[model samples]
Target chain A: MNIEWLSFLTVTLVTLIGSLSLVALYSFAVRLKAIAEDEVRGAGLAKSGAVVCFVLCGCLVLLGIYLIVPQLGGSGGH
Target chain B: MDLTLIVVLVIALALFFDFTNGFHDTANAMATPIATGAIKPKTAVALAAVLNLVGAFLSTEVATTISGGLINEGDNGFSIGPEIIFAGLMGAVVWNMLTWLLGLPSSSSHALFGGLIGAAIAGAGFSVVNYGTVISKVLLPALLAPLIAGLAAYLCTKLAYWVTKRPSGLSSPKRGGFRVGQVFSSSLVALAHGTNDAQKTMGVITLALVASGLQESGSHVHFWVIAACALAIALGTYVGGWRIIATMGTGLTEVKPAQGFSAEASTAAAILASSHLGFALSTTQVASGSVIGSGLGRKGASVQWRTAGKIATGWLFTLPAAAVVGALAATLTYFGNVGLVLVAVIGFGVVLLIWWLSRKDIIGPHNGVSDVDEAGGAISIPTKKQRRKMRKRQREAERAEAERMARELKKAQKNKKKEANGKTKVPTASGSKSRAQEASAPKREARGTKEKR
Candidate 1:
């Protein structure tokens, strides 16, 4: 109900959204991987997309960790 | 400083409860993954253990809610003492062990809440508990979390199938992909579990610290409290809850890779959302519901509804059972020093009894998976009648097999004797001796096994 509570709530929301996006990117990466073996002209495009999504997913998880960390949240995280 | 001893005891009890909580709920995160063979059971737990340790440090909002919001610990002059908390913890831990013995994934959070409520009501009267917070933060979420997670998982499962579907309506390649995806999704659930479930103990410990006047009201969890709690939970997680895992993984429904992925993802989302909202819901209920929903989502998949019903019954009983024990413990403690010692002694006895009884029907890797499905999710040592019947049937089969082998050996001997006698007036001693040995070998082997049995 106060600023501290509000900030915690905000952090929770951010992390929730972040997790969902990571899953979505994972799904995209899987699709790209499925087609990476294709010999078609689009194979290059698929490979790049897969790499980008995997990288993004990894970054999202790290960001989530950073956001949840009390030390990184300046001391009012409770 | 008379309270110092009691405060340390309470903190130790809180950490013990946290350890039980970790193992009890490991099924929530890793059950589906283990069931689907996305990861080996041992490896899955190790992964979950590390993630839970990390997740425990994620947020303290729920911990604050527990310490300050649920039980009346501040200004109303009705401070909950360490003695009451200790009794409550004993209540919670006993219920946890009972449910685990039955392989039921009941809510540890509910047990804790119920124990505290009962203890508080007994010690300080009903006015000491903040009923509004219990209703909104605990009860409402308890009722809603499973339903929401179930619905989400059901829809997500359908989506998974649809996206991966071919003209034949089967997604074989996609199945392999999802099995790999299950590792990630389930790990997320494990991390989410640590963030949510471990905090309940932190909150309880913090509450006890406040009651003993060791910490200020409205303060964050102490660093040592966080570290100890995280370690307790992580170590417990590493040990794994194979009984509950067996029940959730194979007893409730047959989990495929896609279903596993969907269920894990849905569970992670619901738990994370609840944790963020500061709702102390049971992750077990959410995970169980998600699994059931996924089962129903897939076409032609059958749910062991009887097992599901039993689990539901356990969930309904969890709160009241813990509360009753809590109340009794609280009443015992009311008699002062002797009563406190008596409660601890009785609690220790009960814990040893449960553990001793559980050893009779150990659910290790060999028998854990196979026994659960047929027993409707709750596997204990087979009853005397059932075990006797099994033994009788096994003996009958072995006897029948041995008799058949004996008959075959006799027939072969007869044929050899006729052939030998037909060839010469007197059979060679060496040939007859070799034949006798060959004929006796199989019979001897069969006799040896029968005697062993």
Candidate 2:
């Protein structure tokens, strides 16, 4: 059997980085939102930071969709 | 004339398989969100249905070669025809329904492949199969996909908790955000499922058309074929396999929103990444693995090893069991038209029987989300025999308890009468003590029996 170990390793690495980063970003955004809600000093800064994190998360989701849909330049072979 | 009819029948069976596939996998994307109360069960199925419908239309590229070259298509080798395809589909559909009734999440793709390989062996010979491809592509991926997804989910869950941990030791206010994120992440999984799974049915139907000389080999799937497959799958998704949902959602582990979000994110990322890299993985296995991973990540959260064991066993059997059914169907089909009709009759009968059996312990949206016990153990719906035995035991216990209570009541009344007499004529201390011991002994025994029950 000709197993593509390289491809499998790449998938594992990509999945780890992609999933962990997205979770971390989303969690950080939630943390910022909580800080802003507390209305402490620099609440405006925290709110802006939360928005940026959310936007980045949204971009990651879009990238995932782009990868899934073949019409959108994704490999799309299941 | 017979060929055309056989091809049409094959298409119909293929569509039915697609329908089963839709329901079988709905749990993969929606179970966690529903379990965590991030989405209502009804709304989650509806959303998944719509996204699946749209995802089916996304691409037909993979549909051209759905088998991924697992079957030998050489000129001298035995060719796969509509009859073989029909038998294979029968096998896949039967296995799919059986697993659904048991509320186990096995791989639909593996079932499809196993059925086809079994049918091919029966119809042609062993040489018709490419064992190398089976081992390399199908078996290897099946073993590895879950482990990779599980690891990813574990790390993602830890990261989510670490970032959201509050100094006050209370649940962070931002935990609600994870619920919102879960909806989107699970949606992506649903959409990807639509793209990946629906295409397999399309490929099967198109292959049938090609074998019947109604379509060209290597040609694009017909628009009607695509639309029909998409609709069948979407309808099935709308119906929702609530039993499997109950198992995946609550049977494996209790999910909080943060954990649900982490699991979904890990599932979606793994699916997209694997597909993008041209490595196929079952959405069901990846999702289940993620749920287990998240369970492991959370402190004090326990995984139901029994339920997990049952699921793993189902996975191990999915291939060979479906193969046996496919082989049997293929053997029957060798008898020609009468055989075909018999296969259809038997298949339809089995479907109805499973549906009938499911009614005794129906799992629906109302109870699907609450199918676990308070202690986070899966509450398996007992089989008919088990239920009957349980009822009998309960009734017997009730009768014994009732008899004990009656005896105690009579003894208490006698004691009261004795006390009345003692008021009139001073009773001996030894007699009172003996009466007290007689009363307490049975009472203690009754309490012991009750505790045992």
Residue runs of model 2 more than 4 Å from their true location after superposition: A74-78, B60-65, B76-78, B169-173, B241-252, B277-280, B300-306, B364-453
Error of 2 at B176 (Å): 1.7
Query: For candidate 1, lDDT tens digit of each residue in A1-78?
Result: 122345334434443354346556766676677667544778988889878987887787666556555568633233
Error of 1 at B182 (Å): 1.3
Interface RMSD of each: 5.1, 2.3
* Per-residue alpha-carbon lDDT of candidate 1 for residues B325-409, written as tens digits (9 for 90 to 100): 8989999988998898888899989888988977887675433432123222321234447657866876786677667767766
Tens digit of per-residue lDDT, candidate 2, span B348-421: 89988987977767764333432112112322234447656866786676677667666766776677677777
As for candidate 2, its clashing pairs are: none
Q: Candidate 2 chain B, which ten residues in sequence have the lowest lDDT sum?
A: B370-379
In terms of docking quality, model 2 is acceptable
Q: Which ten residues in a row have the lowest lDDT in candidate 1 chain B?
A: B370-379
Name the DockQ score for candidate 2: 0.47
